[model samples]
Target: MRTRGFTRCGVIFGLSVVIVRLIGGSTGLVCYTAVESLDLGCLLRWDCLHASPNITYTVQTKTQGDPWQDVPWCVWISSRSCDVSHVFSDFELYNMIRLGVHLSPSSTVWIKPHKFDYSDFTFSPPSVSVSLKNDSISVKVQFPCATNRRCSHDACCPISKLIDPWTTVTVYNERNRSDNQSRTVWTQEVVSTVEFSGLSPGQNYCAVANFSFPTFSIAASPKSAPGCVETGSRWGMLPMYCVGLALSLLFLVLFLAGFLRKPRRDRTTADNPPKPLATVQDADSSAPPIFVDPCDIHVELVDDHSSIDSFHGFHKAPTSGAETKRSSQPTHFDHSRGVTVQHEVQDMTFESYN
Candidate 1:
């Protein structure tokens, strides 16, 4: 019975040792580093080889010759990251800062502290946008510090006040990826707007930018996500020109047609003058019309007093039956005093007397 009990105890101890080794080897802190963000200020990040449901983490920080202090917002948190930007409120950018990590329920084990200065923080990549002009490409870069609330409130924020800042821009043609151009420009503004000319029209171009601040000892940020734009075609104005030309030609043709038609109309009017319209008579008028016979009528004028008196005193004698019958018919004649006289009978013609 004693031997059996010893064997059971040995086996249990061996199993316990094996379980402890597996947990310790598989679950341990991997890496820790400081990140400087444009929007969030400074942050501390860490990673574990394997995440355990039961393990919680604590982060602590200390400056030179200062006692270790637990991050107020990061104590006993399961998250592997925390914001320590507030720790830099004192504007001690040159001071040496150290971070320590503690795992709960395993208080005996502690990770080594990581030491760094505020200036050593890595910068996050900036945002970028691209636009196309007639034959050029324009790129605009926006840094994170421009929109950070903390930087706005704190005038001493290093990121907000950059020194000797510049951007490296690279332009790539989408059709030929190997065909690219690069330029570096120094800018003092929060947002950098740049124009790149001498590019092929009707081609798709992409731009990427990385920000650098040599004064702060911060390395260049990671390249921003690519922004793309297509330039205007070289013949983009062809349609407009064609439309304008067509309109001009149409106007010229209309003018010529009007000019030619006017001359033709004038020639026709000159060649064939319009005949005078016959005078129209109103048949409904109440006035009577005078009738005159111009062909069968004859007139005689008398200027001698003897002829005028003889005409007044003359009386025709009685004629034979046939002559009376002919004389009975009406005769159209005129007699004037002191004027010449002429008469005509049915069987005899009388000459005019002066």
Candidate 2:
């Protein structure tokens, strides 16, 4: 015949759920950079100076347009003997420039103009890229560059492993010199690796190789991707072993307690059993008396008469002869009317003859 045995399977299911949660919580992303833009060309320096509180010619010039313009020019004040030299054409383009002249003792001032051309400047990606490789895990990453600009013409832009894939590959326009000095400008952080993940075989991936920036960062992808780290059996087996051990210990304690104490209960049951009770009767009194010896015993004697004459109820002859002595001796006799006398002699022993 087949028989069903006791089995608890829920513990295994609960443990499996716990293991799943542990593995699921192990992978996630971190956002390191909140602001990702660098400003475009903005004026780094713009200044106006006034000379003297006096009603001196007080000639001042305001230069407008791009300050980085080169042209040779000079200015002279009619009221003062001082002349300003070395000015640029970009400043002269404006009509009726106001020049503020501060003359303490009438001094000549010299101005130096420096200009930069955009024709010679080029924007390049950062020089260094960081790639982390682990023997057991795989990663996916993308390198985003200026989308509207021709970023691929640069030489030796190191890319990630060929098998790696990229998404949201966007490129930004490089900022000009003016963008650097402005308070508000279209600026973006030059992000190197948009994503980082385990390496794959035969996949081509690209990351920005920074040239000058010393600090680099890594962050988790904002979007979810396939994250699976091949965890060994040991990771899951630890809790299972603990649960099994706890159950075994519990069962063992119960079994030992039952085993140790079961005999005492059995012995108690065996040591004491129900006994029969005797019933008392009202009229049944013919049973022979049963005697039990008393631990404390004493003997009492009853004497009927003390003198011989009283005992015999007769007078005795006072004679000194042998026959008289014999006749005078006391005798144990039976009384008339069927009366019998028992003589308890003073001696411990008594002799009788018939």
Candidate with top TM-score is 1
Q: Candidate 2 versus the native: TM-score?
A: 0.18
Taking the candidates one at a time, how many backbone clashes does each contain? 5, 44
What TM-score does candidate 1 get on C-alpha atoms? Answer: 0.43
Best by lDDT: 1
Question: Candidate 2's residue-wise lDDT over 240-339, tens digit each?
Answer: 8899999999999999998999899989998898795444442234444444343322333444443344334323333333221111223233322233
Question: Once model 2 is optimally superposed onto the true structure by TM-score, how far is the C-alpha of residue 173 displaced, in angstroms?
Answer: 34
Cα RMSDs, all models: 18.6, 29.5
* lDDT of every predicted structure (CA atoms): 0.59, 0.28
Full-model lDDT, candidate 2: 0.28
Worst 10 residues of 2 by lDDT: 1-10
Shift of residue 172 alpha carbon in model 2, Å: 27
